[model samples]
Target: MTTAVAATATAARQGPRPRGLIWTVLRVHRPALLVWCAYVLLMVGWMLWVQHVSGARIRAELDACRRRPEGACIDVMTFSHSMNEGWIGTFIAYSSYGIAAWAGAALVGRELERGTAQLAWTQSVTPTRWLTVKLAVPAVALTAGTTVLVLVYRWFWSADEVLRGDEWYYTDPFLNRGPAILAYALCALAVGALAGLALRRSLPALAVAFGFVLWFHLYLDDHWSELWPMRTITGTVSGHDLDALPASHFWPLHLMTTGVVLTVAVAATGAAYWLLRRRTR
Candidate 1:
């Protein structure tokens, strides 16, 4: 009876097995996770600073301009240009491309190239679950990071409209202004994963993934204006004029684009899973 009780106690102490697959995935990609977290935090911090400190300063300068009406203030102009055209825009574009490259080279391609993916499958992790984990972990992380940045960016963009910053039609601003950024990030990840699965070579996969993302963005940017129907403004004296859609109309357009991009992401992820299954079989 004593020995049986001791055995039961030991069994209770052992508890349930840990989720080794998720732990392994996270462990293998911890460095990328840390970098992504840092990037999100840095962007949020910058937007906060711009919204509170820099925005206030710009407002004050504009007020002074109204009062004095003398010369253009270099500081205000420089700050406006930087916010509209510099770091914010550049960061948004690069981050999307970076994700594609990382997904292709580090996440999927490298594993397949090095036979680690096959080894994982041999260890009882099925190909489908492995692929699912690969997609799910990054999707969640990318959504979280992009959502935070978009919310902060929207605040900053709207708060200082009088400053005449970048317009909504601009490529970077359009992408960064809403949930579309998250969609794009996910699309990039899916595309990269598919490329990696197809090529089974890290460098070539990286190149293909980055190229696809670039092409996708360029095509979208070129055709974005036509995504939604244009509302013509006609005056009795001025006749019909083709005017840009109001800011209120942007959400629908953004939603449509997001849906399209997400569909592509889903399709690519499915293709990758199918390909993996076939390869394993």
Candidate 2:
């Protein structure tokens, strides 16, 4: 018998077996998976293109002006900084908002609203397993994609010190520079699940999830500087330098905030599980 015929015959003889809960969740959310893949591909591709083109521009400008750019070289350098660091960093920082919205509206809320989740529960899949898969699959996808972007951003950022607009201390760049962004994203997912389970409707869940995250991020932004003890310069430093945070504190501040965010993520996830169990019980 041919290989194809043998396989078909084997399958027919074995009969159909039940698909795993994870596989079922993935199949149901295939569109979302595709969208995430596209988003990561497009974002990574764009950042690479920007790095290449901007590297060329910076080199050209450096050569033309002998490294001390006087006129047009400054503009090119500035624009390159905006593209390479400003735009890319901003996207990396704020992309969690989109994740939050989609998690609430598409992943959980709509499934519940349309009785899709309920239908799944009848198929020997416990509600707990269903909810666990729903959160786990997206969390893994988000972490993987976000890790790629963070690595590329760091690679691109290292080559981009000369073109200066965004700095490591800036909110958007700072978040992109560390695990804080990833923590924020996971927290967003958890919060979104909680919102969906609470509202049981797509649009309202989407709005509440997005708004809560927006406020949460803004709060972090305003308070992140206080997460760690700031060192003061007793020496004679001029104007803005007086208020400027010591560069050495970058890691301390970053890690402290990352811990805070991750703590919140864990708490939110706990809340989600608690809520799911309560309602289903």
Candidate 3:
């Protein structure tokens, strides 16, 4: 009877408790996440270089404006719209894509593909706790990354008169807000979770995640006329053609994405829990 009790206790301790699950998830995921960090760092580095080039052009524009009298160089007023015309714009746009999609796809989507959910289930932890930890890790990382992105964007966007001339141009929708990027990334993560849980194939999961990210950008672009409410804040510069939309518009997208991400992640986790527990018992 004592041996039987000891065996049961050992089995119970070995099951998927919160602490064990967190540790297991972390152990399996941390190295991959570190590589993700390196990718983000490289992305930032590339952006810095792009900004440097844009800064030079803005300086040149300002210099030209300064060379003439206010009335003669009045075209300089359009500097706001033109600042994003060249290399920096390309870099920023691409960086935004990378941050918004690829960053989280690898972590969230891959887990589902590899059948790691079953491993977690056999342990004592609940599905809700499992999903929470998975979501938390990326969300925390994105928050920190976004804080830095915002600070850098603000500093660079404000540095030159020409750069600041067009609020919307230098504002670079792709580069302006960290929260927006996070929202987008979370959406992609959720898509990945769905793919992971449903398809159970890594390549397909990643493809779906990538497709969703692409669709999101497309939706924002094609539907901007009707959907401008959730993307930007409104402001008008004295001489620019572009209108600064309100950031309030983007809040809904943020909220919607959050809901979708949670739903997919949770549902998949729950399904995993049900499937695993049913199988094991």
Candidate 4:
């Protein structure tokens, strides 16, 4: 009896077991996690390759082409480098779209539609808790991967302005190289979860979530430039580089847009909780 009591005390001292709801969330979403890992690793490797390997030579050739204008400018190397650098931002942005679709289709809606969520509710897990776990697992995973990506992208963006000479004002460049990446991803997650929970059907939720993300991205494209007041320059700035927005304007617009995205994310998450409470009770 003393040994049994001691064992119980030791177990209690250890706190909660490792095999709980969080672990179950990881297990159920293992495939998605694996895919996220693969994508992050691949993107990091590609960025490093472009930065360290192909950057300097491409910059030299492009400069030479601009200076001479008579030599062959449309070389394969230039084309290849431009193509790689140009699409990276779009690819990174599109990952959020995929995440939103997956979150709606497989993460939340499928569970509810197939009765798995209801079954889990019959256990000790409350309905609210179940929904929280679903959102939290993907949110954590996305944050981790996006953190890695944003760090690597910042490094690449800072190091060399060679073949990858996209301006900061560009949408993809703005997103891939800053905190906005994380904001956009979390926003996608929350919106997708809300779609899943509200619809309770897999296919429809998937389409709606994906479309919603795309629409938001388009909205940003339309209005992001106006987030912060533009810096006006005096004098003959026409045709001068000063006619373009300067480096000084980069962070203000970036931060403002990121803040906007994050606000939407919080609102969607709040709506999710409110909806959950109403339904479960």
lDDT of 3 by residue, 210-271 (tens): 66667755665444334334243335466544544454545454444345445544564456
TM-score of each: 0.87, 0.88, 0.59, 0.86
Candidate 2 off by > 4 Å: 1-5, 8-18, 67-74, 235-243
The deviation in Å at residue 62 for candidate 4 is 7.5
- lDDT string, candidate 4, 244-269, tens digits: 46778888888998999999999999
Clashes of each: 0, 0, 15, 0
Over 1-281, each residue of candidate 2 has an lDDT whose tens digit, in order, gives 69999999999999987469877778888898898889888878887877788667776767778756456445666575576667777778998899889989988999999998888878888889988889998999999998988888778777666675677788987888778889999989988988899899999999999999999999999999998877665555554335468778788998998998888888878888888889888
Better of 1 and 2 by TM-score: 2
- Give the distance in Å from residue 41's predicted Cα in candidate 4 to where it truly belongs: 0.4
- Please tell me which predicted candidate would have the highest lDDT against the true structure: 4
What are the clashing pairs of model 1? none
Q: Which of the two candidates, 1 or 2, achieves a greater lDDT against the reference?
A: 2
What are the lDDT scores of the predictions, listed in order? 0.83, 0.84, 0.54, 0.85
Clash pairs (backbone) in predicted model 4: none
Q: Which stretches of candidate 1 lie over 4 Å from their true place?
A: 1-18, 69-86, 234-243
Question: What is the C-alpha local distance difference test score of candidate 1?
Answer: 0.83
